[model samples]
Target: MSDDPLPFLDGPWRLSMGLRRLEPDDWLRVDDAHDAQMRLRDRLLAERRAEVAAALPGSEAGCAETLALLLEFLPERFPERWTRDGQVMVDRRNGRRVALDGEPPLVIAGRLVQEDLCLMRKGPDGYELSAAVLCFPSHWRLAEKLGRPMAGIHAPVPAFGERLGPTVDRFMAGLDADRPVWRVNWSITETDELFLPGDRAQRAFDPAEPVGSGLFLRLERQTLRRLPQSGDILFTIHTSVRPLGDAIVRPDHAAALAARIREMPERMSRYKGFHLMGMPLLAWLDRLAAAQVRVAAPG
Candidate 1:
């Protein structure tokens, strides 16, 4: 079995909530790619503000509370890189001092961390997407999802309404402020570009290039925490990508991933663009798995 903690690596990939309790200190993650990702976020916020950030009329209080919670949590979680001085928060990694006022609170919060921040508030129907600063959406648009409820926002995802909708709603409804949770979702793509707001039909893999050369494994680590004051769930998505070639180093992992790709439901395969990958990708994975097995066998 692979030593990787990522659930998807284990394989026969299935869609489920799969949420785990999140330690308060581990709320935000910072890594080597922080500088580059932050720069991209800054550019998007400045150039594509309307596309990346939005809030409903009455979501101001929730937005402000979300920002306040982050301001208190970030410095405490990552003291070395993040420090707050009154309304000005300093990021030592890029030497950027962010003023916590004037601009929308969600926008300011998005600039401080790698995760795209989203606020979900309880409405008559259910939890609605009240506000968000979604800089790196995988294949969806922030504009389309804004002001939408849980089920409505995920309407495009196949079987989501029938299979996972009610469970997600119940979980969101009962989520406690002190106890937060996190889960992961993954996808395969041909590009490493993070800003993907277009439809899945736009994805195309070149036939000439080697199957493994440009393939990428994209993972989104999502966290949901109910704010103590506003009772709004602060949803955060931290996206990371790795070269597919680098992910299948171990024989077991390679085999598991291959089985996952092969066994994925038809609709999901098409939804995730695995059908576009076609036989070439599967053949490549089989070869990689066999090679890894040979290399790992007893000398």
Candidate 2:
């Protein structure tokens, strides 16, 4: 029923990958969406600063100065290259990338200066391209796990659903006529355990893709609750819908993406990816909870 070229049910891997990568046209469509988001954030930050300044209008106290002073006492007090203007020149490390804005730009809450900041880079078409993603770490991880990284991914945690609709709209609008659009979704589960099956963990794996062997283990509800309390890990899942050889949801594709995610006893994120692609809410949770169970007790 949907006119989308990449049907919600199937596999044109190239198209799927393209959806994740932003195209030039997409940028123009979502330009305002991104701008509005940045403006709103700048306003809030400015207001907060004003409120603090109003509270201590005459006080010369400076948090940055105090932090710098404290850092000075450390044995490895190497000079950080902060500009005279207060903008921080933090190294663009391989880990997570954060963006900051005006004034003195420094790391705040493990993110960059500008929360909604985007990056434009040269693409194969010889044109500058842009894409927006969720917050730093989440988007960073998603980008790394995918076959092709998101041209731009930002999720302003400080701002949630407020920007999701606009962000997605802009992303969709920018799709290259030669590419497929990606479907992105997120959810919060009550349980702490998360798992991505070896098969599902690898994005490129197909049914014919050599299947890994494993057995389903049952875990008690009480046991599940105790290992790690709720709110332990923030589960963020990203997927792109592609057209497969014989596209049909009846193969239980929806139920597949909803597979349970359980914390690997020894690993931070390594877990089974139950492909419960399009299942309804309640059913998906039930399967996720059931799919993931406490590791079998040692002898």
Candidate 3:
């Protein structure tokens, strides 16, 4: 079990190229919550299949190429639960039952519901989002972001250019397909629901509202790689959600998260939807910290 809880928020926020080389084994995580999470994924895919999954003509080649690579990569990486046969990859565990035929983006996108898939291609306008299957979006819409460049994609984030614009642009430009890079981002969500899209999707973190105080930390393990054959970027977002209460079971999480949340600047708070519940969220974290101390005391 990983010790780090709320990994992106467990430390002081900093502006830097905080990326790492991703190993084969770390590509996907199918945990104890696999069945329940997959049910939700299946439901979303069934209900909004056409809406959630689509791609432009420019992205078709990359999507097919990406699917081929994933089919090869998964079985080779997790031999116990996954296996590849010709152009198809089968989940030996029968977990993510997906047909390998049909649209390349849909087949690849439906590989795992917990993970959202996006493809970017370098056009006259630099890298643009050519295709995406974003089933578990945090608080944004795929329709709004489709075909948009990095700047338009991050328009909601205040002063993003000064903070992360230049750094991310350079990172993507230099990203290598052979050696993929990965990073983590975390946010506190009021609901445990995985597939929250559109403007109403941002989770509130107020203690005043009992419904919003559950505090399931949403973490996205995002990976970036430029496809060797297509020269397109393949970005995968694998989301993991765990109750804050459960996370505090591992030592130091509560105190660290409390400090980190309290120190968030105004621009960040607004973008993360923390302005509505930042104080209440901090208070709740403090209570969790006190409970931890009480449990550890000599009794």
Tens digits of per-residue lDDT, candidate 3, 267-298, equal 77777767766777667667766887888899
In terms of lDDT, model 2 sits at 0.26
Worst 10 residues of 1 by lDDT: 1-10
Better of 2 and 3 by TM-score: 3
lDDT for model 3 comes to 0.72
Tell me, by lDDT, which candidate is best: 1
Candidate 2 residues lying further than 4 Å off, grouped into runs, are 1-21, 28-39, 48-115, 118-254, 260-284, 287-299
Candidate 1 global Cα RMSD: 2.3
Better of 1 and 3 by lDDT: 1
C-alpha lDDT of candidate 1 relative to the true structure: 0.85
State which candidate, 1 or 2, has the greater lDDT. 1
Q: Sorted by lDDT, highest first, which candidate order results?
A: 1, 3, 2
Write candidate 2's Cα lDDT for 1-299 as tens digits: 12233222243111122234324222111121233333433444455432111111111122233223223322133223222223332422222222334343211311222222222222342212122222322223323332221233322222223434354334433534344223333222212222221123234223332121111211111000000111111111122112321222332443332232331121212222233221233243344434334223344
Candidate 3 is scored at a TM of 0.86
